[model samples]
Target: METSLEEDSRTKEFDGVIFGASDQVFSRYEDSSTEVTYTYILQTAGEFGCFQRILVALTFIPNILSAFFMLGGTFMLKMQPHHCNTDWLLAIQPNLTMSQLFNLTLPRKKDGSFEECRMYTPVQWDFDSIVKYGLNDTQDCQNGWFYLSHEWSLITEFDLVCNKASERLRAYCIFVAGLFCGSLLVGTLCDRIGRYKSILLMLMFYAVFGLGAAFVPTFSIYQMFQFGIGIAIMGYTISSISLVIEWLVSSRRVHAIVLAQCFLVLGHLVLSVLSASIPHWRLLHLVGSIPVIFLVSYIWLLPESPLWLMMRGNVEKAKFLLCRAASINKRIIPPELLQKLTNEKIHQGTIMDILKSPNLRRRTLILSYVWLCIGLGYVGLSSQLHKFPINMNGSHLAFRLVEVPARLCSIISMEKLGRRKSQVLALLLGGLTCLYSAFIPEDLTSITTTLALMGQIGLSAAFTIACIFSAELFPTGLRQVGLSFVSLSYSIGVIGTLLIESLDHDHPETFMTVCGIMTTVGGLLCILLPKG
Candidate 1:
């Protein structure tokens, strides 16, 4: 958070400028050296607007699939009103109806709902006159639970309700733990092998693992699939998007990244529709996995980032892609001119590079905090909303719908407000609104829903901005490294999301307040980061 003049000098030392490079590229240069030495892949590819469009298409589906990956858990873990099965009671009185059995055998709580975990009278296998007298003795469910609805869930199938309900949260935490591991693995692959190849591997893993999760017989086996899904989700995300983004100049970076981000929002909306329409959790996952087969075209169709190729010292390959891009855009660059562009190597980075470089180090630390906070607050609030009376389909759709406008606004504000301020503003506004909403009594449902929606919008916007901000802050070599750290933080945040289960029901204020504080702290940390 230091503001010393020395630190400012250190930030400025990251080569020439990046953000303002677009304007300078077109401006009257002082000499030939300026024009020759400074050129971005975007500037060279801008003539082919179709190229960007195609790249965006390549990036979009992966983002949607990533959202679907997480959404599967929402549907899979969905809870329903359930209680001890009436089979034993039915056996005692074979002629009794289902409703009659429930009334006679199940214990009712203060809420007038049948208790899910407990039942009236023990199953001593001695059905005497006590059955007709209505025995008052109560005991924990011994046989199995009866799900009120036909819609199957892990909660109903595995008896993850009542005391063991916390297992549901633990399951998701394990998934995110896998994501943390995946981010590191994918980051290394993307950094070493290349974006295109790394993503192909990820998409394959996603298809096999994600779809395979649907048929698992045991909850423990299902968890293994969830873990693999997490790994694939984050890997597909970083590799595909980073590849396309790295090829673009700063001017279109926000638009391209936001487009990729919007796909995730759209994916979430699609998930709501799928969850509501499909009725079965397994079918929903099956539908989501179908896209993986379609994305196989990416193997040959998607091109490697020319900048990445040059950075990898593949000048000839980079030249071929550039020619293909130029052909697609219908623009011509002189052979001599294109040859000189790949003259220097874009620095290859190791994990230590992020720590050793003063400018990169500061940006990484600040962005990591912001990423972690956004994940924590955003997931915490979303998870808390599950207890409310909001319609699952409508709320889920509306929640994702808002992100579209929020991200659009960020694209405009990013240019005007700059990275740090826009990001800080997003975090601050989201945090403050969440805190304010905590004070509103639950009876005021309308007001609370509005505030919750606003909070999501802000958090969504902050998350988008922070991602773009991170891209601009670090050099290409260190970009994936920074992404790895950010993903690790976010995965930890998702793990922390489990806390909402304990806190959301009893101490509502405590839940909202903790999420608010984290986002606000992220904002403060963002202020210390130098503008890119």
Candidate 2:
């Protein structure tokens, strides 16, 4: 009799018919009783007030760190100008200038560029013997390689130039694989353990492995750390974003998400400055990841999601958090609203929940494909930007700057046109821009550069919209799982981009064309998704 009474109370609390705020339905309750729902209570607490703003601000730290760890690789693993390390010749001729040394020991191609991987065989004789012998022989770098700049990079530190060049691609693949695996593991953890705990756990992983990446001595060990960073970053991203969105009401969710994405852009901007100022990759990575130590203080500062608490049937805790939010927002939650907050224990969603339902399965497939294209297009264009005539800093700054307007546009479009159309518009615009740029002649560097920036703008908007849309499509219980599944496709896309680059390093046009086609297809499929 006692257990049956508790079940009856749980059903009454959750089965209440609630309506939107616009309808002025706050006072309505099930059986004409005063048992309000979490949604209504969250609205009553205030949607876009002081509490939400503070949470949004806290998210910037992780987003910026995400940029550092994710895009930092652009500079950290870059291919610097290098040649065979032939400094041994200096032993015979101490006065040899760098130009003299290169002219004597290195072979030149038909276009007069020195061979980067091979140098003439060295001899013990004085420099005159080498000059007299006319140095016709060449072999793989006998000593190793020398970079124009001694600054640390994967290329310089790992000797990834000649035979080892392929290792860079392999390292990237390993990192992406980590991201894929982390999405599954962390997404499940977030749903099972609650968002706050998941964030804390992922932060620990991110900081430890990120620092480990900076200090590891060998390329093999470095790859191991990179893989760990990959997993940690994906988990951090999914958990943090989910936490933020869960706290916000539907009306403010898009705006808050857009605001958080701006921090991600700022992260890239900060990364550009740091990359320029910090010459050593290890030090740069160290600086980027070290902030997590400070961020750990969030354990005391951040609050658990009240809705999650309610879903887990910790009604008293949820009520306390709601009251706190209301107090901070300077609103009074009537005692009656808190008196009947008895929610049942909702089942935590799993990957099977997404697959068992046909509606969810369709949405997951479509959103996953969209996410995949967004990842490929965004990373592909950003990676290829250096191929243009602009300087490196300028390209990076310009690319990140575009996101400011792009995300702003996303907010407006999502609010005005709704999710499906907004996503389709952003994707198509990005796709067409990329495709058009691909056909442009290589001589038109300015045109190509401008078009690339425009394409990124569209992609940036699409990325922001996709994040919100995917979250909204799933219920709170399944939100993290659904997002993780979609994000797995993103990892696949990144890996695909890397493979394309490895296959055709010389022709970025082919890669861009492929990205454009895939993005367009993803956008067109959005039409089939159920309308908002």
Candidate 3:
């Protein structure tokens, strides 16, 4: 049934919008209409009191756990110390020690690290003839490699170095591809299923695929698992974020977004520490999957988004969620008030709805460009964190651990500066810092590292605010689709990680400068979006 708001909307002369806006942005300001109307859940129901605080926590904590799985592939696939086994030399001389066997079979680099891919060809089996030759003639490793560590990685197990070195990077790319495919499916599907159920399903699959990857007998099987985890990771993230967003007042929206990010970074820190301490890569994968399984019980605690339930014309379901929220917050919603609740009269959204409108299309296009830029810039900066100067163990962990506060600061700036201004500030500053950091001399490592961290702070804040603002641009029905669409740019940005690494081999600054330029362009385009 249409609400009193819909009946009122019909009676009044509508102006300025035709396609649609999300419930949050679906405002009509008419010259003849001196009176105002509010039919949104936030208007009738409570926001930002104890109920919403609890809502945001429940939705975001699972999202944080999902972040742990996102980077598991990176650590699990890491290159370990390895070299040609050179077992043939043992057959020739069984008495030789391992160090002696290596010195006789492998060539040394300038600083004395053994060449991993090459071994000296043996012309004679006798020790005297071998000593006379002095290890000159070399051939690529014919025998399999012997990894230094007791634990095995994809690199060590598959011999992913040298000829197969490029293959090692494939897992990261495939993981991202899985994310893209998931984003494509989730936005529409989650909109069909309620957010609460969708998240539970995602968590279930996240655990399933993560465990499968941990014990897969072959790389092909592992790839299948990695792809599914990608879908689960992104589906849980966007849906949870959208779920929390629908519950908040505009002022609390910033906190909701950044606080979730803080959890994600915290999860990353925990994953890094776990990976470092774990003896086996498979064990690390198992560890990453376990926490998500434990978190699945949160389904009973989480509520479906009332705003979404209402948008889908499920008024009864919406009422149930609202009443539950009110009771949990120690407040009461009178039955009479809920009796007034009604769904807005709007057509269901599809991808065509986004493309068919001129104003929305323009705004979505601009936001999309910024999303792509933000994605690339963020990934580019992250790819460089290992270069940061530090004397401590787990220095990469230290670099990531500090991002929590950077995300926290966005809560203040997002409100104070407003969405558009903060985005512009972050993008501009982040781009400039990345450009400058790229040129700093290696000798000035501390100074250069500081510049990168500053870049992360700016870019991270920009990325966070950009998402909240993007959701605001679309109506509830298409908000997930819109978020998913724009976030595909982020998946596309994962390619930048590969590009930067490839370019790092020769023209190190090329990709960094490219990231700077992209972000700068994005900041300029973000100015064209309506201020949220």
Candidates in order, TM-scores: namely: 0.91, 0.91, 0.89
Query: Which order, best to worst by TM-score?
Result: 2, 1, 3
The reply for model 2, stretches above 4 Å from the true place, is 1-36
- lDDT score of residue 409 within candidate 1: 94
In the range 306-364, model 2's lDDT, one tens digit per residue, is 76786678888888888888888888888897776776755456777667566667878
In candidate 3 the C-alpha lDDT for residue 484 amounts to: 91
Model 1, global lDDT: 0.76
Number of the predicted model whose TM-score against the real structure is largest: 2
**Candidate closest to the true structure, highest lDDT:** 2
lDDT ranking of the models = 2, 1, 3
In candidate 3 the C-alpha lDDT for residue 252 amounts to: 70
- For residue 359, what is the lDDT in candidate 1? 57
For each candidate, the alpha-carbon lDDT, in order, equals 0.76, 0.81, 0.73
Cα TM-score of candidate 2 = 0.91
- After superposition on all CA atoms, how large is the RMSD of candidate 3? 4.8
- Pairs clashing in candidate 1? 48-329
